[model samples]
Target: MAVFRESNAAPYLQPVPPVVGDAKVGGAAPHELSIGEIIRRERRLSQEQIEQILQYQREKGVRFGEAAVALGLASQQDVLFALSQQFNYFYAPDAKRGYSNELVAATQPFSHQAESFRAIRTQLMMRVFSQDDVRRAIAIVSPDSGDGKTFFAANLAVVLSQLGGRTLVVDADLRGPRLHELFGIESSSGLSGILSGRAETSVIKQVPDLPSLYVLPVGVTPPNPVELVERPAFALLMRELLSKFDHVVVDTPAAVYGADATVIAARCGAALVLARQGRSKVSRLQDLVATLNNSPAKLAGVILNEY
Candidate 1:
C-alpha cells in the first residue's frame, strides 16, 4: 500500500537519525542484519520499541517486521527495503536493461506489480508447499494462446528466485517457446534434446544477473511436442529437475495443444490457470478446468492477469 516514486536511485540507504528510539550502536552491516535488526538499525527504534514489537509478534503469531509496521514504528517501505537488503535482491526501476520490460519482478522490484507476484508466491508456498502432501513441480496453463501464461510464469519464477530458493522455469511450450527470448538465452538445445537423448548434458541455462534462477528452453521445436512430453523420459526428467531445484515452474502451451498442457500439469502434479482480462472466455476456461480436474494435477488457483 506504500507508493514509491519511479527512480533509479538505490531503494535502501543508511538511516539519517532516530525517529522513534535511540540510534543503534555499531553492529552487523546493513545487508548482514536480520529483518528485526535491520528495522532496529534503519528506523532507530529503541530497544523497548523493538521488544514491544517482538511481544506483539509472539502474541499474534505474526512476523516482527509486520508487527513493527502495524505499530507505526516503521512503514511498509522500511520493512521491504530491509527485506531486500537482507536477501540481496536487486531493484531496477528502469526497464530498458535487456530483460523484458514486462518482467516487473526483475525490472521493478518495489512496484505494485511485483508485489502482486510476491503475494501469489506466498499463497502458493502456503497452499502447495506447506501441505503434508505437497507438490514441487507446477505447470502454468491457459485455455488459449496470448493469455499471458508465459509472461506470468517468467515473472513468478523470478520472484520465487528472489526468495533465495533455487527456482527453475522450464519452457514446455514446444510449439511456440518464448522463455528463451524472455531470458535472452540460446535455445540451441534444451527439452527436446534432453528428451531425445541427442544432448548429453542438461540444457538448464542460468540467468546471468539472477543467480538463483535457471531456465530450460524448448529446443528445436520437434514435430511431435505432445509425443515428446508423453514419453516416460519426460516424467523422469521432471523428477530429476525437481530433486535438484527448490521449485520447478513449467510454462506449457494452451489447452488447445491437444492435451499437451494437461499432460505436463499431470506430470508436475500442480497447475496454475492464467486468464487474461477481456481476452479469456469464461466458457473456455471452465472447459479447461474440467479437463484438468480429470488429470492427476491439482488446480492450484486461477490468476486474472490484468496487464
Candidate 2:
C-alpha cells in the first residue's frame, strides 16, 4: 500500500532559482591546453609563480586563477584574459570601447563562447524555422533575474544577423529592461512606447556595423507590464515584426515574478529557456518548466549558460 503525505506549502510566488546543468547551447571543440598552462604561456605568471599557485591550489582546493589572485601574483583582469584565451572566449580589456567591443560575437568571432551561440542559432533554425506553420518570433526566458537572458538574446541576434538573416531583438522585460544598454542605444522609444500608442515605429535603433540586426528597447517602464503584454497591441506588434524581420528574438522578464513571460511566449508560439551554471536550482527549474508547459508556446530545449 502507498502512503500519502499531506502537502501544506504555498505555491512559489517569487522568481524560482535557475537550474544549472552541463552547457547545452553551444558545442565547443576540444582544447589541448589547460587554464593554468594557458596563463603560464601568456606570461601572466612565471614558472616559479605557477609552482607556488599550484602548491596553494592543492592545499586550498581552489582554482589556479584563484590561487594566483590570492597570492597577489596576477590581477583578476589578467586571469580573466588568460582564461578567455584558454577557453577561446572573448575578452575586452577596455570598458569604454564601443558597441562592437561590447558584443562578444562581433568582437571575437573565433572565441568558443561566440561559437556556442552560433550552435544555439543552428539549433533554433531547425526547431523554430524548419516548420513552416509557426511564426518567426522566439521568446527567451529565464527562471530568475541575472540568468543572462538579455545577453543570450542580444548575442544570438548578432550571430543570426551575421548569417545575413534580418534579425530583431526586442526588450520585452519592461520591469528591468537592458537591451538598450547591451546595444548601446537610447530607450526613449520602444515596446512600452509602442504598446502605449506613443511610438509609431517598432524599429527603435539599428545596430551599428550590422545592417541586418535591429533592437527594440523597452522605451519607458510601465506600471503594469503584464497588462501591457496581454494587450492586443502586443500581438499585433509581434506579427508586424515577424512579417518584417527574418528572425525575431524577444527577451522577457524572469518567470518566477510575473505572468509576462507566459503571455509573451504564448503569443510568440515558441520559447527558449536559459539558466546559468552554479546559480540555478533544480527544484525551481522543474517548477518553472511545469508552468511553461502550460503555456501555448512550444518549449524549446533548455540552454545551460556556462559563462
Candidate 3:
C-alpha cells in the first residue's frame, strides 16, 4: 500500500489522460480509470514497471490486480484502495489520515460495523429521506449517556455522505459537545454561536477525506445550553441546513439531560432513538419514544446499540 502522507493532501482523484488500448496509459475520465491506471497513479509505478506488470498479467491470464500481487508489485490493500477510488467510495485505509477511529465508516469501511451503518443508512433513505412527510434532517436521540448516540450519528453521517450527496452532521449537544473532537475540526464557532447570532455560515466545517461530509460543532458551549437550542433561531438554522444539504444528522445531548433532545428532534422534524443493549432501561426508552411521538417530529425508528 502507498504511504499515508499529509492529512490535508487532496484525496480525490485528479483528471488524467485517456488510456490507449494495450498501453493502459490512463482512463478516458477520472471516474472511468481502469484498474491498471488507478494502481499506476496511486503507487507511482513507472512506465517500464507498468509494461512489466502488463506482460506478467497476460502470461498469467489473471486480472491486473492479481498479476500485480503475484509479481510482488502491489499488495491486496493497494488493489482495494484503487478499486475504492475507481468507484468514488471514500474511506481511509490508513489511521494516520487523522480522523478518529470511532468513524468506522471512514476507517474500517469494509468492516461489519461499518456495513451495519450502511444498512441503517439504506433504511433511513427509504423511510425518512425518500418521504415528503418528513424533513431531510434526522436527530439522533438516546435514552441515556454512553448509549453510543454520537458514535452512531457520526458514522451514519459518513455512510450517508458516501452516497455522493452533501451530508451535514450537527453537534447540537451544547452541554457536552464531542463531534468536533471526533471529526478533528475546530470548535471555536458552531451551533451555539449561530444560534446566539455571534457567528454566521463560516462555522460549518467541511471534513477532510470524505469530500461530501460536513460538521457543525457546538462552538463556545454557552452558559445556557437549553436556552440556545430552545430559541427560534435554532429551528431556522435547521431549516436552512435542510435546504442546503441532502441529508442532515443531528447529535443531541442524552435524554437524561433535559428536554434538549426532544427539542432538537422537533426542530429537525425526525428522530431516531438509540438504546444500548444492557445500559438503556426499557422505561426510559418508552418515555423518550412517547415524548417524541407527542412532538411534530416523526419517529424514524429505534435501534439497539450492541456495537
- Predicted structure with the largest TM-score when compared to the true one: 3
| Model 3 agreement with the true structure over 1-307: per-residue lDDT tens digits | 0100111111111222112121222434435788887788777899888888989988989899998888888889878977886677766777777888998889889898988888888888888899775565899999899998889999999999888777889999988889988888888877776777766447778787676788888889888988888888787777777767888999999999899999999889899999888789999999999999999898989998886
What would the TM-scores of all predictions be?
A: 0.72, 0.68, 0.85
Cα deviation of 232, candidate 3, in Å: 1.0
Displacement of the residue 202 alpha carbon in candidate 2, Å: 6.0
By lDDT rank, best first, the candidates go: 3, 1, 2
| Candidate 3 vs. true structure, TM-score | 0.85
lDDT of 1 at 21: 20
lDDT of 2 by residue, 12-46 (tens): 11221211121112242213456666556545567
lDDT of all predictions = 0.78, 0.72, 0.80
Weakest 10 consecutive residues of candidate 1 by summed lDDT:
1-10
* lDDT, residue 256, candidate 2: 79
The CA lDDT at 60 in model 1 is: 95
Superposed on all Cα atoms, model 2 deviates from the true structure by an RMSD in Å of: 14.4
Error of 3 at 200 (Å): 5.5
Give per-residue CA lDDT, model 1, range 1-307, as digits (tens): 1111011111111122211122122654445568888778767899899889989999999999899988999888777767766556734334444677777788778778889899898888877777765546999999999998888999999988877767889999988999988878888888877776676554777776566688888889999999888988887877777767888999999987678999999989899898888898999999998888888898888888887
Count backbone overlaps in model 2: 4
